[model samples]
Target: MPTPSRIEHDAFGPVEIPSDRYWGAQTQRALGLFEIGEERFPAALIRAFGLQKYAAARANAQCGVLAPELASAIEKAAIELREGRWDDHFPLTIWQTGSGTQTNMNANEVIANRANQLLGQPLGTKTPVHPNDHVNRSQSSNDSFPTVMHVAAAIEVNGRLRPALDQLRSALAERSQAFADVLKVARTHLMDAVPMTMGQTFGTFAHQVSNALARMDDALPRLLVLPQGGTAAGTGLNAPAGFDGFFCATLSEVTGLPFVPSPHKFEGMAAHDALVELSGALNTIATSLLKIAIDIRFLASGPRCGLGELRIPDDGLTSSIMPGKRNPTIAEVLVQACFQVIGNHQTITIANASGNFELNVAKPVLVYNLLQSLRVLADSASVFARRCVRGIDVDREQLTTNVERSLLAVTALNPILGYDRVAQITATALRDRVTPRAAAIALGFLDGDEYDRLVQHPVNCLINYPTVNRAAGA
Candidate 1:
């Protein structure tokens, strides 16, 4: 038999909804219309919607607008929604109405139904708990959806993404300290440049993550400003006098975060500049992560042929038909994730730019891309920290061989011998395919005793005669 359905009426006539679903008419209409993508809103954003509704209901009640009993019912129902109950009912795609009207009404209908059911009323009964007049009493999808967007993005950055980055930074710091003395040849423009401790290499990456974290921290204050009270067109049409203050205070109390109403509700609703700024910060972080991951991949390139300066943990899966080959899969995965984040940032930027006079028609897509970027970056950081960064080990033998063979070692003779003589010695070393020490001896630039005294000094070409003499002698 065909599935049973129920007739639900809205302003635009009636919609045939599935019998068992919690969503009502507007949601059913949206489901039938917007078949744009399979991607739905992130659970965090949905939960944010619930929290927004719950706070509004309490605020309306406090302002003597909504009945306390109905407000209590809506609050209870919204709490269930925020806790992830009835997630399946929110089936609209992320490509729905730009104001996210469909999803907003989806929440309203679900909350109203559940609230009525709590009061011993039958399903679809709008009595005692109407979806519009009471549930979404003083809010519009225009303000409400962006409010949830700001709230959700702030929480995700502070709660999930930052913590993951901190973990990655700590892992790198540990490796930096652990490899403090492992000398390695540094590369500039893919050529051997000079010598640096592996600790310094890892420390540079740690500092990149630290700077990214700081940028994100700097963007939080803007993200905390929400566009909640400006219903419809930033005019606060039906909302009471102190509704915005009460809503923000209630939201702060419930979420334990400092969520304040935007001073310019028009800016908050019309332009998503804050989200654009946040996405830019995330893009910067993604760039740093990609650079770090690529560097790690290069350092762990090969066991025999490539750089082979570092050894990465094998994740058990091997190269096809090559039983002994272990790829730098974690770093590759992280790089790919960062690439997605970068691309998503661009999409958010364009969406932010597409806003018209009074309202942006790109809210849904903007939110979807932002949350996806955050999720991917957070997960990538966690995986990279555990699988690659924490377990990386320096190849001591390879490091030593590369350092000894580098032409940059000729840097030591620059102070003792004139720059012209050091240049001649370096050219001779490269031309003869011999070590700098051998070239120096063969060209009589320095004797074996002097070459050893200067070239193999422990401080690596600081050129302090007394310190060099003591280190060379010791």
Candidate 2:
């Protein structure tokens, strides 16, 4: 038979918890009470929690509040957690207490158990490294949870998201330069309107992503201001006088993130406006990515029926019945990922507004959505860069054909021939379904020699307008 369950008692009542589990009464209680979702916190968050506890233990020990041995044990255990050991031990879901109190306790209990084991103490014994007093000496769940959110988000954006975006931008820039001279018909309102180089179009995509990355950087300062010192209600109630400063400095040292104590702990604890701003940046990025992905799909729409300006990478998955159908699989995946990020942004926005007087009751959902958005964007950006943008092949034949076929090419002749003449040429070209060059000559708008001289090169008409000496011609 299984080992008999152990009874743990908290303020509320006694509950039977698994003896083998590292979590204590509060976490056990939460596990039993909240079965809302299967979505647990990711390893990044767990590592962040470890970092927070480790910094706290080190700072508390340095401040002479925690015993040296206990602090050392907690620090070691936190390191293990930070290095991703025993990640599965953190079993609390993201649907726990709004303040993330349960997950915080979950971290506290796991660290306490591991530390106790290191000192030859048995599991569930909260002595030597008591979860609340020693491990969480100068911090509260209110502050620690939010601090970890910032820590995790900062690390991800700096280490993963930014680099991923940079790679994607580089890929797009490479394509832009490679296709610099590949002219194509420009579309406005989904109709042929003008002419532009493929390079110019891709360059705009690169700039949009670059701007989004800058926005993420701009929001970093706000995220770096942490709420670690704000214990119960942002008043530093049970924490020592200099605990905030020491904690921030120690955490910064530990994580390499420039974390500073929030001057107004109330704002940090009560409102997640910094996260909201970051989410807004992420939303903008998703919007840009959505546009980029959709544009790719549109350009690679059909080899026979639609604008086949691009050739998508053949992912080897052909349609079962259609014989040969190469889908824009990578672009579609990026598009779907961006859609999720956008929806997650809406969730974050609504959750951010749920902040009450001195505390926000939407911490779990806000952090959940924030992390999800970051992960999705980073992954999507990488895939898009490597599989989509890098492998993209320009359909030069289609591009050239469309450029010559477009009626808007007639606009370049306006400066030399006058707007009335150009407009008449365009109308006739559209109605007769002929090239503007053919239409102009057919309509007797210009002599064959003059028309030939003016429309000497289609590319020059689109990009480099010839300096037509109308006075000489007239």
Q: Among these predicted structures, which one has the highest lDDT?
A: 1
Estimate, for each residue in 40-85, the C-alpha lDDT of model 1 and write its tens digit: 9989998998899999999999999999999999999999999999
Q: Candidate 2: where are CA atoms >4 Å away?
A: 1-15, 447-449, 452-458, 461-474
Backbone clashes per model, in order? 0, 0
Candidate 2 lDDT over 1-474, as tens digits, reads: 986777766678887778788788888888889988899888999999999999888888878889899999999999999999879888888997789998999999999989999999887777777888888888888888888988999998898999999889888877776777789888999999777878777777877777777888999888888888899899988888888888889888877888888999988889899999999999989999999999989999989998999887888888889888788888888989889988998999999899889998899899989999999999999999998899888999999899888888677687788999899989989998998888888888787678767665555543432111111121
221: Cα error in model 2, Å? 1.2
Scored by TM-score, the top model is 1
Positional deviation of residue 103's Cα in model 1 after best superposition, in angstroms: 0.8
Model 1 lDDT, full chain set: 0.88
410: Cα error in model 1, Å: 1.6
